[model samples]
Target: MHISEGVLAAPVLISGVAAAAAGCSVGLRKMDFDKTPRVAVMASTFFVASLIHVPIGPSSIHLILTGLVGIILGWASFPAILVALLLQSILFQFGGLTTLGVNCFAMAFPALLCYLIFSKLINGKNQSLAVIAGFLAGFCGVMLAVIIIAAALAISGEQFITVARLILIAHLPVMIIEGLIVTTIVVFLRRAKPELLKGVV
Candidate 1:
């Protein structure tokens, strides 16, 4: 769920923005030329994957495929997410311009984590393990994003407990769906396009 600009307080938003900037910087600096194609795939996947919106309770949520992004792009997922988020803000108004950094951070942190985890697994010969790793990474990424969003709201407005709770509850199902799809996608890609994940290690 995209947080409206007015929903979060200044301190939380500012902190999120700072973190987002750092993440983007690091992700961009670490991008390798050999991995450019993979990162581009990640950027496109993130942009397209997020289009499958589903309404759980009060808010609408969508699949992020961030774990997939991480597994493919590694640390570069941060810049890729920033790109996708920037476009979303301009085109769909999914997130506001002022909050773009925060929104990017919320989505990108889990992606970074996923990249770390998937990097290790892909180094192994067992394809199944890699797929499983991808699933877990995706699940964690979704959960962490939810937590980040809640934390930002809580920090911004002390009275946002109900809002956070509602968002968490609504996103639970979406997370599960995302997890399943992520796992399946990872396996499919592993079989169909192993080269895409070649340099993630």
Candidate 2:
């Protein structure tokens, strides 16, 4: 799920880095230091979530839980994802430091968007829509990330288009799997732990 170094050209990497810095700054200001405990819990969730994988064709897929992270933590997701990805990169080499910013934007931006979109869904007296939106958020989120990666790869080298094609093809089943998992989780949470959605539990 992480984009490695040398996969993107210098320009893309630089632009992603700048966007990451801006995102982190905005996310930081919105972070509530007083609720460090919740942040810690979500950080742990985000950390452990990536370890559980589902096989999808040649490449395996993992549960990013970006939707869950966003629903619970809001804008604080930026640092949470940053910390988790850094740990993964250092400990497991799931991604590299050189491509960290691009990967960060790939994952964290969707998380932020999930927060915005889901909040409206849940508050509008449409539980089903909220669940569906949460599901689609996770589904669409990965595609968006893949698109970014593919575009970055395309610009990196003309030879990379085949790799991009493989990526786009490989992720279709993963997207479906993500949608199912995300929907199931959201529905379960809505019925069993509604407080979590309201940002209280």
Candidate 3:
């Protein structure tokens, strides 16, 4: 989900920028040169996945795949998501430059959180547990992102409260779809490329 330009107050925007900067700093520091190509691929995936979005009030509904990205890239999801959002803004105008930090933080923070919560389980020996963790990571990524976005909108103005509620309602299907998609992908990667899940963070 992307919050359009001029919708947030100055304080929120500044806080977003600061938070994004901190995340990117840590992400860059932890980035592995050997995995640079993987990061680029995930960034491209995020860029393409979010391009087809349905407008809903100030934000939009779309596939983010942030959980998969986070599980694969760990802390690097922040800069990867930032790059994708930047390209989306410049090339398609899906989101504005002014709101880049907020959008990036909204999507990437949940990604980081998912990685922290589920990465170990996904890497564990039990395939069933890994699948469940994958689903939960995917489901929670969207859920948490929605909450963060709703909070941002609500904090901005009372007028946006209804829209925030509508956004949450509209994204229920997306959350489930993401969960299934992530589960399948996690299974495939585990079978074909288990190394990808190890020591990513």
> Which candidate wins on lDDT?
3
TM-score-wise, the better of 1 and 2 is 2
Q: Give Cα-based local distance difference scores for all models.
A: 0.76, 0.76, 0.86
Model 3 TM-score, 2 decimals: 0.91
Cα lDDT of model 1 by residue, 1-201, tens digit? 467877777787888889988988888778777767767865786688778886666877667776667777767777787888778878887778778777888888887787776767854678778777767877877888888888888787769988888988877786787777877777776778777765442
True-vs-predicted CA distance for residue 199, candidate 1, Å: 5.2
Model 1 spans with C-alpha error above 4 angstroms = 32-38, 53-61, 199-201
Clashing pairs in 3: none
Tens digits of per-residue lDDT for model 3, 35-72:
77878886786677666675556876677777877787
The TM-scores, one per candidate, come to: 0.87, 0.89, 0.91
- Model 3 whole-model lDDT (C-alpha atoms): 0.86
| Per-model root-mean-square deviation over C-alphas | 2.7, 2.2, 3.4
**How far in Å is the alpha carbon of 19 misplaced in model 3?**
0.5
